[model samples]
Target chain A: MALNIVVCVKNTPSSLSVELDPSGQPKTAGVLYAINPFDEYAVEEAVRIKEKNAGSTVTALALGPDADQTVLREAVSRGCDAGVLVTGTEVTGGDTLATSRVLAAAIRKLAAAQPVHLVLFGKSTNDSGAGSVGGQVAAWLDWPGVLSVKKIESIDEQAALLWRMMEDGIDKVKVGLPAAVCTVKEINEPRIPSLKGKMAAKKAVFTKWTASDLGLKPEDAGAPGSGARVARYTAPAKRGTGLRIAGGSAAQNAAQLVDTLIERKLI
Target chain B: MNPQGILVVALNQRGQASPATWELLGAGRALADAAKQPLFAVLPGGTAEQARELVERGADRVLWTAHPSLKEFNDEMHTQAVCAAAQQLSPARILLPGSVAGRSLACRLAVKLQAGLATDVSEFSPSGMVKRGAFGGNLTAEVEFKSPIQVMTVQAMAFPPAARQAGRAGEAAELAFAPAAARTEVISFSAEEAGEIDLGGAERIVSGGRGVGGPDGFKAVRDLAHALGAAVGASRAAVDSGWIPYRHQVGLTGRTVRPKLYVACGISGQIQHLAGMSNAANIVAINTDPECPMMQQATISVAADIFEFIPLVVAEIKKRKGVPVAA
Candidate 1:
């Protein structure tokens, strides 16, 4: 059986170059936005699954400002079958729960149109790094789910075989049709899109929706609906003085290094 | 449905609770104690008799759902069971130790419950707060939760274990779960050869970075670790350059370690490398560059070359331990 897959992705600032404005919120001014790095893995995995199965269709979905269509197009370039953007100001300030609710609602709508065999997500976003969104989405949909999937062993029309990494080793797991799977970077090497693919993505018209589109109330999809929230944000403490050993040969350097370690009783 | 409120998933391997589960008991107990909640442990295995052991180990209640399919972790089934219980009790929060399994399940559960998740937290503040690394551990971001039913996955060693009581008896609730057969199966798993202990659980770790030239350079590191009865760790640079196996790498892309004592030799501490070992009780750095970031963070900084100091350090440890250095 051919599979239908949906990848939930986000557009985030490239790095920690974020600052809080007067309100002490993340400063978005002039910060460049790109596809969440981890989500790329999700897209890549979906495409790979589709390629392996031959008849699978992969849709890349994002929930953010309408401008995020640029990021959606990027997923298309990487071989997604379609692109979707769930946008609205009410969707803002959402924690993972709210985020998952919106995505889950959109997923439900999409599933009603065509069967979705699997839902994919990155392990976590660079901004939140909470790694909770995918799990929450799965719960909202009442679907069996897996996270930190490092490998996909088999994917037929009806069931999927995969592995989850553990402290001791990896465990093999099988999920029947219509399951959700989240992956870490270790899962697979995400492929870069080709120029031809990028051209195709640029021309593709992405579908747009909002909370109303998914039949969600405002309170059901943002901070008000989330189960957890950030209390504050702080900078990391500065590490010790950037100390460097003075002029010395490799042997001399080794000597000094050991002396320091010994003095600190480190070795 | 078990009435004992919250279900704490015990960290088990090959059908035994990892010692970390007891530590989780402390976290679980604190939450339960605060919320006036009751705590239960979910252990998957084939033994019913072993259920009492968890109670003895401080579980207020124990639930064992065992099957042959449960022999190896079937996350789908296990997660479903945990969620099934959560749905029944509706605990204010689901607490899991920030181990690999905990992170995986916590995220999956969040999606299921449409709840919020906090991962790898060193300390959790009940004031709706979560602290985690940012900029590769170069900074920490304090996060606030707007959600009521918070989900936190904490590091194993972040909190001390609850005081071990000799015989604190609690109810053991055996669960009936039919493990869903998994499609992917573990063919075989071979632990890294035990010349040194696993970095994750090592009491002492000696790590090296780019300064360790090549594979041959690891000899000094190995010798030092051997003398000190420690595990060996490497920075991403060393691993990427093929100086060490990726398994032995310690950094953002590698294993995060919390050893009692961490000795960094000739390593220029990058944020990524520091994230893996900053939690060590004692950090000692040996480097020629006094300005090296690792040195500044080192509780003790030795400005010397590792080659010169390693041999003597090895000899000193061997002499102190009265163990002859193996040729």
Candidate 2:
């Protein structure tokens, strides 16, 4: 079967090295953006599935500000057939529910044209690291969702066998088609984009979707319709000042460390 | 039942009431007490034995249902069960563990209910505010639910497990929901080696990173872990390098853990890595880099090579515990 897959990627800071202001909000100054590391695995997995099953198509779906296009381009460079950027204030700055609703709406719209057999997501976004949008989207779409997916054992029009990775073990799952899945690092090694692919991505144009385009109310995307709202941001508690041990030898340091632990009853 | 009662999803692992469930009960107990509302535990997939355990721990009442479909965790079945329980009980707030399954299920339940949800919540203020990690715990986002029902996945280990009352009495009822066929089937389960400490329940953890060099370097970490009765954790770097298995990886990309003590050996902390274990009661960073983020964040920073220092510390801990040591 020629499956149609939608891989959602998040555009996050290239590195988590950004500084938090005193109020604990991340400072945007000097921040560089790139495709989230985990999403690369999802895009790679989708691309791989597309390659094996000829005539299949992979659509890179993103929801954020205009900066999201960079992530989509990267996805295209990695073999995604097309891209869709869901942006604008009415569809941005949402918590998991809002985000999931918007993504599910976008998927619903895409499925209207061509039935989407599967939706793929990374383990988590580096920024929020909530690790739930994939399943939440599945919920909104009324589709079965599997998280911590390590492998796609097999997929056909009717069903897909997936390996769900848990802390202690792996559970093999057989899910009905048109399911949403979140991929983990153990799935596959993501490939680097070739020059030709990059050139193609440079010239590529992404289809944009918003609340209205997806036939959704403005309240369905952001703070207005969000179940959870950030009341405020606070700096994390400070750790007690460190006690540095750089004394003479390994034995001396070890002795001192043990003594401290004993005195504090930490051991 | 009051409209504002706190409903806890008391989950059973291998048909037993584990610490994770008890922890939810403990937090739920406090929340219910503060609100002066009854505490309810919803056992979506467990027997009466586990339901009794929930009452002994903290629940004032237990809503238990043990359908054959729930014997194994299928997302649709669990969600349907939970949604059914929520619809009937109508809890003001619902809490679940912030574990992998817990988070996944919470996400879906919130969508199904169209409720506000906070994941990895560390604290719930009496005035009805939720504090959770955002930006990988670099910042704390205080969340408020706009919806009528609030749902959250409380951070595991953030609260002490509720103490069991030997003969506490509580009400128990079976939840009735129209059963539907599950959309997923569990074919098989292949678990890691038995006897390895499950990181979610581990009280202490000793972790390694790229600085550990290779597979052999993990032995030092494991030795120290053995001495301290701690679980072994690895950063994504070490796991990706094949020095340790993915199960041991503790970071944003892996498991989020909140142990009593987290010891980092040869691991220069990445923000994503710190996101997983930053909530530990104490952190000790043993690395040569005095300026690394891990060292800066550690309660105790040791400036020394892990290879040379780990053995001495291991021997000292062993000596203190009256265990045999070469030195």
Candidate 2 TM-score versus the reference: 0.96
RMSD for all candidates, in order, please. Answer: 3.9, 1.9
Mind giving the per-residue lDDT tens digits that candidate 2 earns over B222-294?
9989888899999999999999988898988788889888899988988889888989888989999989999
lDDT of 1 at A113: 94
Among the numbered candidates, top DockQ falls to 2
- Highest lDDT, which number? 2
Model 1's chain B TM-score? 0.89
DockQ values of all predictions:
0.39, 0.72
* Quality of model 1 by C-alpha lDDT: 0.74
lDDT of 2 by residue, A231-255 (tens): 7777687676588988668899998
Largest TM-score belongs to which candidate? 2
If you assessed candidate 2 against the hidden native complex, which CAPRI class would it receive? medium
Determine which window of 10 residues in candidate 2 chain B has minimal summed lDDT: B10-19
